[model samples]
Target: MPLAGPVALLAVPLGLVAFRGCSTCWVIGPTQTISSGRLERTCANGVCTLMKAGAAASPAATP
Candidate 1:
């Protein structure tokens, strides 16, 4: 019983490192990206969607 106690303590960190390999196997969450050509854009989550100071792209579209 005394010998088993020391082994269990050492096994904890080893078990945690071993388990990390399989932890990222599942695609449980979404990976999203959004980009824009505008220069005044603000970025968040590795992407920029909103432009700054209302300075949008020139040449307004007409239909």
Candidate 2:
């Protein structure tokens, strides 16, 4: 087998492990933000709620 093939296959699992619990956030509009992933429980605005594992996003009421 070619060396490139093995390298490519190894990268897949490494990538998954590196980003397993990664979270990302996006600023939408002027005062709205959205986040996704397993590690996003709190944000800068302090209005986000803690979501249970496997649960969807559940934001707190905005003032």
Candidate 3:
């Protein structure tokens, strides 16, 4: 019984710190997705970029 109490105390702090580290390591919000004929758009981590489809049937690139 006494062992459990001390073990839990140590585990709680370690778990909390570990969780805090992970919380900052993840990309949080500003995520979006858009789909068009031959192009797809993905926005994440405050940055947006384009993804093109290489299939021969895909639509041509647009300016």
Candidate 2's TM-score:
0.26
lDDT for each candidate structure? 0.58, 0.58, 0.61
The TM-score between candidate 3 and the true structure equals 0.28
- Candidate 1, residue 19: how far the Cα is off, in Å: 0.6
Per-residue C-alpha lDDT of model 2 across residues 1-63, encoded as one tens digit per residue? 589998999897787787675333212432232243444464456666565447765565899
Model 1: lDDT to the true structure: 0.58
Q: Which residue pairs show backbone clashes in model 2?
A: none
Q: What is the TM-score of each candidate against the true structure?
A: 0.30, 0.26, 0.28
Question: In candidate 1, what are the lDDT values of residues 1-63, reduced to their tens digit?
Answer: 899999999997887787775443433322221223333556656966655456755564699
Model 2 per-residue lDDT at 5: 94
Model 2 is weakest, by summed lDDT over 10 consecutive residues, at: 25-34
